[model samples]
Target: MSQSRRNFLKAMGAASLTAVGAKNAKATPKNVLSDDRFGVLVDTTVCIGCRQCEYACKVEHDLPAGNIDDYSDRSVFEHMRRPDHTALTVVNGYPSEKDKQQQVTVKVQCMHCDHPACVSACIVGAISKQENGAVIWDESRCIGCRYCMVACPFQIPAFEYHKAIEPKIMKCDLCYETRTSKGQPPACVEACPTEALIFGKRYELIQIAHERIRKNPDRYYDHVFGEHEVGGTSWLYLGSQDFSKLGFPDLGTKPAPGATEPIQHAIFKFFVPPVALYALLGGIMWLGKQNREEEE
Candidate 1:
């Protein structure tokens, strides 16, 4: 091979390695879970299906929260709803297994995993898990890759596909910026008329959840939903029936990243994939052909 060809190959190899290293470093999460980090305990038994928390979340985030009274219309509860770009947190009603006449209300939002998969999936480091147990997104840094949306076990992160410009990935940030940072509970927790949502240190919340289950063995399902799911989450839940019956996914105790990170790291460590390598070599060969043609 020509000296120029050797130099080109060396440069391409170095570039590929550097790119892989940069991506791996950027994808790694910087934040560590703190012992003092806060969490919310959602007691579904105490919830009234009033949808007050839903209204509060919208109002706090300055979303298109129509009249507060509009949330009282129970017709919306007939169909299941997930949090989207407009609403970061939503209250969903499910029929009680024991009594079809009675309804169980569950509020859903970002679980804010102790080991957040979204943080590990964001190539630009746009998504981060804060020390206070809030998983937040930085719109300025986000390239709208939607990797976080795919990584999240709860399917919480939402994309603004409708917007043509400056679209956002939206999810509940635990009211970190507006409420928790100032030593206030999240708007949803505060607005819960039945006081079903309790906010406190994560560890404390877990203890409270278990204690509630212990005292009212018949009332609770004897399981704290988020205590061990996806290596624990900041949003713990207490339910009358199994969490799955209330729309919660049956995730394993292992962190979501634990299942995929090793494979990703191995691939990146090996430099470019086969397809990328072929594309790079093809480009190099085409460039060399052009150079030889110019000389002729």
Candidate 2:
């Protein structure tokens, strides 16, 4: 084949592959909401600010876990904290609206949304909503895009900014790989002394949350925090006061990706844009060559 023809063929082949990749990147996976998927119900009202869950999480993930007794320090609760790279979960203390002397503790972690924005935002399918109700991240597939961090409504995904090599997007995975996949509760749930975090089926947890609120209306805020927020979540919450006061975002019933996915699908539907761009580039090359030959 002629040099110009060979070059054209190579360029077209690369463009086609690029186009295919673009289409696949935006393709939404089947939204899985299994009836028997496991979940954790966090009773903020029952938490004691012990921070055992935090310690357990660190140990489980092989992070820099300090002495277990160190978690007994209630002073850490003085300032509100969120989950970060060092700790996948953290407990924060909030003043009880009902009682002046008592404080309510809330364990913060990934909500593992039923319709995860991270999974949808990922350009490389690095994040996935598992059948077991865990929104897990595959480090192997992650290209350090940090889209998951931006997409999360709870702002749960944490990036390892300090690591120069293979920095990770860190968050709670509900022990899917280490425990739950083997039919065991997460390290945090197992460590809670007060049973504040209950691990069970997602549907069952919702039922249990409502039952608690129904039986003790005065103790609960009359709403299960994660039951419907962003189209529900695997990590449910029950609190004494407004969730907003406890540092929870007030989100709507619609899933975070609902507004954007349709538009994305439309744009990438037939891979028309990539193919057109490729063809246009080829035409430009051909025209340039023709003009040069005429002058010669």
Model 2 residue 124 lDDT score: 96
Q: Highest lDDT among the candidates is held by which one?
A: 2
The lDDT for every candidate, in the order shown, is 0.90, 0.91
Instruction: Give me the runs in candidate 2 sitting further than 4 Å from their true place.
Output: 1-31, 286-296
Query: lDDT per residue, candidate 1, 30-54, as tens digits?
Result: 4558788989999999998898888
lDDT of 2 by residue, 16-48 (tens): 999999999997675478698889999998889
Clashes of each: 0, 0
TM-score of each model, paired residue for residue:
0.84, 0.86
RMSD of each: 6.3, 5.2
Q: In model 1, which regions exceed 4 Å deviation? A: 1-31, 270-296
